[model samples]
Target: MPELKTPDSLETQSCQVILSVLYQLNLNHENNVAMSSERRQFILDCLQPSLRQRLISMITYSLNQDLNVTCKLLDYLFDSGIPHLDLITRRFSSFYFPADQVPTVYRLLSRGDPTSLEKLCIGIHLDHSEEGDWEDEEKETICWYSGVKRKEESVSKVLVYNSYFYPTLEKMKKLRHVVLHGVCDNQALSIIGQSCNLLQYLDITGSSDVTDVGIQNLVFPPAIQKAGRVNLVNTRARTNPSMKHICTVLARDTGVDVTGCIILLQFCPRQWI
Candidate 1:
C-alpha cells in the first residue's frame, strides 16, 4: 500500500477551500444547507479580524436584499466583538435592534464609551406597531445615550424624532440638523429654541399640536437666528393666517432664514382654523 501523507499546510488550505466554497455556494441560486452551515461555523472559528470585517461589510451591503444574511452577520459580529465597530454602524443605517441584541446595543451606548458609536439615528413613533414600545427604562436609557453629554467625539450628526424631541434637543447642543415629525407642544418647542442654538437645519413637519400661538412663541436666540434654516411644513401653522404670522416673525428676525416655505393652507383641517 502506498504511504498516505497530509501536507504541513493542509489545515490552512482546508480553511481557505471551505471559505471559497462557501462564498460560491452563497452566490448560487440555491444554497446547500449542510455545506453552508459547516462553512459558516468554520469561518467563525477562524477568528480573523480582517475576515470578520469583510464579512460584515458584505452582509451589510446585502441587508435590504437579504435580511437573513444581515441578521446572521450581526450575530457573528456581536459574538466575535469585531473590535472595530465603525463598520457595523456604517453598515446598519437604520438601527437594527434584533430582540436578542437590543440589550447589547443599549449597553454599548449606555457605557458612555464614545468610540462605541460613530453615528446614531433614533426614530420614535406614537404607533407602537411600527416598532416595539420602548419601556420607560429603555426610553431613559436611549435618552441617556442619545443625549449630547454621552456622544463620542467622533460623532458629527444626530438625527432624532418622536419622543426624542425633548430629551435629545435639551442635551444635544451640538446638533446641526433636526427633524421634528410628530407633535411638539409649546414647552417642547421652547426647550429646543432655548437649548439648541447652534442648529443649522430644522424641520417641523406633520405637527398638529404646533399652532400659530406656539409658532409665534418660538423666539430663536440671536445665534440661532443668524445660522439656522427653519422649515414648517404640514403643521397647524400651514394656514394663511398662521403663515402670515410665521412670515412676519421671519422677516422681523435677523439670524434665521425661512425662505423655502411649503405652506399648504388647504390641507389645514377645520379644527386648526
Candidate 2:
C-alpha cells in the first residue's frame, strides 16, 4: 500500500478551516443541518490573524452574490474574535437587495461594530414599476417599504423602518446621518440623542411612536448642542401643535434645519410658506 500523508502546514489547514466555515454558513443560511457548534469553534481556532484578514476580504468580495451566507460567516468570524467593523463596512460598495438590508443591519448592529455604523444604510426599498412588481410575486405591498438613499459616497446613511435598534446605538460613536421610519419611538430617539453626538441629519418620518419627550431629548442633549437638520414629517409631533413651536425654537436657537412645517399647520390653521 502507498503511504498516505496529511497536510501539516498552517496554510493548508487554514484553507480547510475556511472552506468548512463557508460550507457551514451556507448550510445554516439555507436552513440545513450545519456543522456542530463545537466543530465550528475548533475550525475557527485554527485561523491566525493574517488569515482572518484575508478571509474578511474574500468574504466581502463574495457578499453581493451570497449575502445571506456571507453575513452568517461574518457574524461567526466577528464573534470568534476577528471583530473589525471596517471589514463589514468595506463590503458596502456591493449592491444589496432592498429586502435583505433590515436583517443585515440587525446582524451588523448586534455585533457592536462601531466603525461600521459610522455611515451605515439599512432599509427596505421596492422598485414600484408594475413590470418589476408583477415579475417578483413575493414583493407585495406588505414587503415594500421606505429606506435610505446613498447621499454621498463618503457619508453613511442608515435608514430603517420600525427600528427598535436603540440598544445597539450606544456602541456607535461616529454616526452622522440617520433616517428612520415606522415604529421608532421616544426611547429610541433618546438613545440616539444620548449616544450619537456626531449626528448631522435626522429624519424620523412615520415615527408615530415618538412624542414631545423624544423631541426634548433631541433638542436638549448636551452632546448635540450644535445645529443639525431634523425632519419630523408624518410623525406624532403633528398632533401636538405645541411641539411645533418647540422645534421652531430649537431651530432658531441652534440654527437647526427643522422641517415638517406642513404638519405644524394642522393646529394653527395658517400657511407655513
Candidate 3:
C-alpha cells in the first residue's frame, strides 16, 4: 500500500467544527431530508470550495444510502450549478450504493474515467415491510436510504438485473474490493470474476442468485492469463448452500477456499481472514 496524505491539522479542526454545527442544525432531520433546492444551496454557500467535498462525504456517510438516493438531492443541489461537482464525482473511488443506482453508476462510469474507481460495493436495500412489525427500533425510517423518519408507507422496492449495467462495470478494470449483499446475481457475479483482474475482496452474503456457474467464470476464465491480482473472496453467504461444495471443489487446487454465505470463494486462502 502507498502512503496516504493526511489533511493538515487546521483542515481536520475545521471539519470537526463544521460537523458539530451541522448536528446542531439538524439538516439530517426527517423533515429536512428532501429540503428545498434553495436550502441545499444555503448549506453549500456556507462552505469553501475546498471543504465542500468533505461536507458532502459526511452527508453521504450519514445517510448511508445508495448513490441513487443521495444523488437525487445532489442533482437538485447542483441544479443552479456549482463548482467542484466534477471533483466530488470524479475523485470518489469507493462506492457503496444500492443496485438501483446501477444505471446512475453506469452514467458516472461512462462520463468519467473508469480507471479511477477502486472499490465498488453493491447490495440490496433491505426491505422490512413484511407481514407485521411493532418494534420502534425495528421499523424502517425515511425512504430506505435517507436517514429521515418515514412519513408514510414506502414505495415499492426495486431489484436491478439489467444487462447493460454489468457491461459498464466491466470497464472498471481497476476495481478492487466489492460487496454484494442480497443482490448478487449469477451474470453480474460471473462478470466480476472474469473481468476484474485487480479484484481483491468480494463479500456475497445472504444472496440466493449466485451459484457455481458464476464461481466457475471467476475461477476459470475462457482464455489463459497472467498472474492474477486476486487476494481473497469472502462469503458469509446464507441463502444458497447448494453451490458451496461445488465452489470448494473448483477452487481447492487453485489456492482458493469455499465457505457458506451464498457461496464464499477465496482467491488466496493464505491471505483470507
Candidate 4:
C-alpha cells in the first residue's frame, strides 16, 4: 500500500503525541530500560518517515535548548530504535547523549541500519567553569553540560581524554561529509582521518584542538584509509545546553535553510572510493 504524505499540522501533532508517549514510558522504567525500549521501538515503527523526522527534530531542539529533557531520555530514544537524525548534529554541546562507551552504543543501535547515516557534524565543549570553584587537580570530571543547570545534571568529561570516537565514526561506512567544531582534538581528528576514509568534504572550523597533525591524516589518506574495512565496537554517554551551544543550535534550527543564510553541503560519487 502506498503511504499518504502527512499534512503539516497533522505531522506536528503526530510528533507531539509520540514525544509525550515516549516521555511517559521513559519515566515508567528507569531501572529496566529494555521494557521502554521495546515500546519505543514500536512507536518508532508506527510513524511515517515524515512524522519520524519531525519528532527527531523536536528532540534535537529540546536537547540544544536546555529544556527538561535528561540524558536517560536520549538513551530510551536510542535504545528503542535509534531514531534517524534529520541532521547529523553540529551542536552536540551538553553531551547529554550518554558518555561511557558511546561508540559502542552507536554500534548497537545502528546494527538495525548501519548505513542509515552519512554526514556527521559535532561540537564538543572544552571550556572550564568560570567560578573556579574547584581545583584543577581535585576536579576529575568537568561537566559536559552548559553548567547552567543544577550540578546533578552534569556528567564526567572523560570522553575526549580517552578518545573513543574513531570506532563510532568508522561504523558508518558510507559516511561522506564530516564537520567538527570546538571538540575535535588531535587524536580524534587523526582517527577520524583513519576511520572515515571515504569522506568527500571535511570542515573543522572551530575545532581548536586539531592542528596540522590531524589535518595531515586526511590530506594524506593512503597510509590511514582502509579500502573496504568498515566495522567497529560500541560506547555511550550523555548532556544539555548554553552560549557557545546556543549559536550552533540556532544556525541549524530548521531542516530547511529557510533564510537562505547558509550554504548547503552535499557529496557525490566518491572519487577516492
**Pick by TM-score: which candidate is best?**
4
| Candidate 4, superposed: residue stretches over 4 Å from native | 1-8, 48-50, 62-114, 128-162, 194-201, 205-208, 222-273
Error of 1 at 26 (Å): 24
Overall lDDT per candidate, in order of appearance:
0.37, 0.45, 0.45, 0.41
How far is 105's C-alpha from truth in model 1 (Å)?
A: 12
| Model 4 lDDT tens row, 2-118 | 999866687667667767777776667656656866765775566555555456667765545322343344433442223344223525433433233334434443433434455
How many clashes (backbone atoms < 3 Å, residues ≥3 apart in a chain or on different chains) does model 2 have? 1
| lDDT by residue (tens digit), candidate 1, 156-226 | 11122223334433554443444443334445555645654443444454333343434433543334334
Worst 10 residues of 2 by lDDT: 248-257
Return the TM-score for each candidate structure. Answer: 0.29, 0.43, 0.45, 0.52
* lDDT of candidate 3 over 156-192, digit per residue (tens): 2222444556666666655566655545555666676
Candidate 3 or 1, higher lDDT? 3
Q: Of the candidates numbered 1 and 4, which has the greater lDDT value?
A: 4
Supply the global lDDT for candidate 3. Answer: 0.45
The whole-model C-alpha lDDT of candidate 4 against the native structure comes to 0.41
lDDT of 2 by residue, 100-207 (tens): 355565665576354435444332333323223333434322111222221122211232432546556666655665655332455666666666666555555444
| Candidate 3 residue 84 C-alpha distance from true site, Å | 17
Q: After superposition, how far is residue 44 of candidate 4 from its true place, in Å?
A: 4.2
| Span of 10 residues, lowest total lDDT, candidate 4 | 235-244
